[model samples]
Target: MIKVESLTKTYGGFTAVDNVSFVAQPGRVTGFLGPNGAGKSTSMRIMVGLTKADRGTVTVGGHDYLDIPNPGRHVGVLLDASAQHAGRTGREVLALSASTMGLPSSRVDEMLDLVSLTESESKRRVKNYSLGMRQRLGIANALMGDPQVLILDEPANGLDPAGIRWMRGLLKGYAERGGTVLLSSHLLHEVQMIADELVMIGRGQIVAQGTPADLLRESGTFFRAVESTQLVEALAAAGIEASPVADGYRTDAEAIEVGKVAAAHQITLIELKLADGGLEDLFLELTAETQRESYQTGGAA
Candidate 1:
């Protein structure tokens, strides 16, 4: 498990992280989210001892990250995929990490395969790999020791749809196996799909933290039809009140009822799901007052 308490960080006159606190439990994926420069990166850096916190405490597995022997064996981190040495081969990077953690050479090969990097690709220099391939290599390196806890920042940034899907499944399986995953990403929808808990930060402060269902104030079914007008008519005919939200309609009716209504009307639904108010809606609502149109005032937290 990862726990952070009263964490604060500052740069010169600006406060980067303001007494931020959150916990990532084992056997669950915790999604860390924020706008650019909201101190999401800074907090993660502190957790891994990459940056010193001005005040407060952070611990991984009941001990400070720096105090852990062979920390990589217990906690994996991928803060910046592009930070790997350009001169080294993908295989060499994992090999070096494995060596540092006293892992066998076979572990390198296992990770490379797990991330779907072929022998040829692993042999290529890191400078030559595409962003997606670099992400894969970075993941391979992080998992080189089969760490029990993972702290990843934007791990899906460069992945294609299929690659993202692959990663979602991999992380889900890892959590199901009782590992802890603290994932930070701008992909809110994907995070909503996989994360068991969420932490939202704004202006260096935690704006909200909870499961998606807890944060979403609206309880209903959301559905969008190809012919929205006619679907609204059909729903009204069925004595259901619906309100427009995003590109869809939200109704107090359950998903099955909405589906049945659409089916009876032959309305083609483009999307249908329970309205746990979606992550996008929750993010925008909670952080709207705190969001900066540009990061100029927020600094490079």
Candidate 2:
């Protein structure tokens, strides 16, 4: 399991992470979600000891990551797929990682196969590899030691649809076997499909954390009326604010209440349903408030 308690980090006067806390348990895939500049990467860096926390702590299993013996064998990490040396071949990269972890050279071949890198591709220098191939190589390197936990940041960034599907299956299988997984990504739909739990951050602080079902339940209703302008005016008159959406308007009002308002306004209903765009809608709602605050404060996104 991974435990992060009151984790904080800052750069100059800007707080990159703020008193954040979350847990990634074994046998579950935890999705770490946030908008750009929301400290997802900063928190992950602190978790792996790549960055120092101003306060609080992050631990893998029961010990600090740096304190763990043969850390690679205990915690597999792939923060940046592009961080690998361009001078090395895919095979060479895995071999180097294996050597550093005191694993046999045969482990390199296994990883290459596991990540489905062809022999030709593995033999070519990383500089010549496509982003997808590089991502595969990075994943291979992370799993080279068969670690008990995995922390991947935007692992699907460069993947194709098929590659993304494969990665989802791979991570699911890993978690099924009792390995802890915490991955951060902008792919909300993908995260919704695979993550057992979600931790959403905005402006360096956790705004929400729960299972997909729980988050969905927190989402408001979405309704559209035949006469959009009249409906908006009617809802406002009823002391309810509604925002215009692509299809129509969105409000926190339940379907029953919206129906009453539409009926009173002599407006016909076009569409009325819960606005559950799954994780996407929830993520946007959670971050939109912070985004507005950032604009007002002239803070970096």
Candidate 3:
């Protein structure tokens, strides 16, 4: 539902986003992930036409965001919850958003209830609302138009664990109902749990994009184990190589096949385990080297 092509953005000499491209498909939640200063927010801004890209284009359902008639009716964005008016009550703010979008005032009330803020402290100014409450109000505002696409940057920030889980379920429900969701967050575990696909950026470039499982599978770690003392011989016979692990062997062979080979050779199974590399492990490994390289370059300078 959302497509970005070679989107590039620069400020003076600093490139904030560089030739990044990715797609957010309908009926799926796509996680936009990157480290701090990795251009996630910048890219999001460009996608929504809040910030113009130096090069490339972003389209929502084949129309440029700026050119889309009633863009808010098609894309619900919560890039910054704090961007709301501090003096207005949450209901007032949502009502205003609804009015601006030519949507019914009833939608504002529905969204407030949806976000569980229907009985919020009556007549309280937004400045008095807790961060989490404000965040919920922001979500309500985003939902006022019943947009088909949601672009939420750190929607889980400041939310309690329960609230975070609620948010996850909400997004999942939205996607299940055919809405597209693009979520940007620093919480890898949350993203790992919720995202159907991942778009990972590093230093303003897309380092990886795929299903979380696919990315993890590609970068996954493998373990090789053997039960008998003739471990090296068994591996050689099977045309496999093994490396010494802590009190065992670590090989990039399938555990079931390895076990079958061991059993065939009468190798007693002492210890055997497969270490599947997960999303967090793979994400760290992929981004850590880039951080180290940047640190080294900075030190040299």
Q: Write model 1 residue lDDT over 1-301, tens digit each, in one string.
A: 9999999999999999999999999999999999889899999999999999999999999999999998888999999999999999999999899889998999988998899999999999999999999999988887877889999999998999999999999999999999999999989999999999999999899999988777664456878899888988888999998877666777878888888988988989999988765687668656776776521211243
What lDDT tens digits, residue by residue, belong to model 3 across residues 7-101?
Answer: 99999999999999999999999999888888999999988888999999998888888887887888899998888899998888887888889
Model 1 misplacement above 4 A:
217-277, 294-301
**CA lDDT, every model vs. true structure:** 0.89, 0.90, 0.81
Candidate 2: regions farther than 4 A off: 233-240, 260-266, 289-301
Model 3 stretches with alpha carbons more than 4 Å out: 222-277, 290-301
Across residues 94-169, which tens digit of lDDT does each residue of candidate 2 receive?
Answer: 9889999999999999999998999999999999989999999989988988999999999998899999999999
Instruction: Write down the TM-score for model 2.
Output: 0.90
Candidate 1 structure lDDT: 0.89
Q: What is the lDDT of residue 102 in candidate 2?
A: 99
Ranking by lDDT: 2, 1, 3
User: RMSD (Cα, Å) of candidate 2?
Assistant: 3.7
Best by lDDT: 2
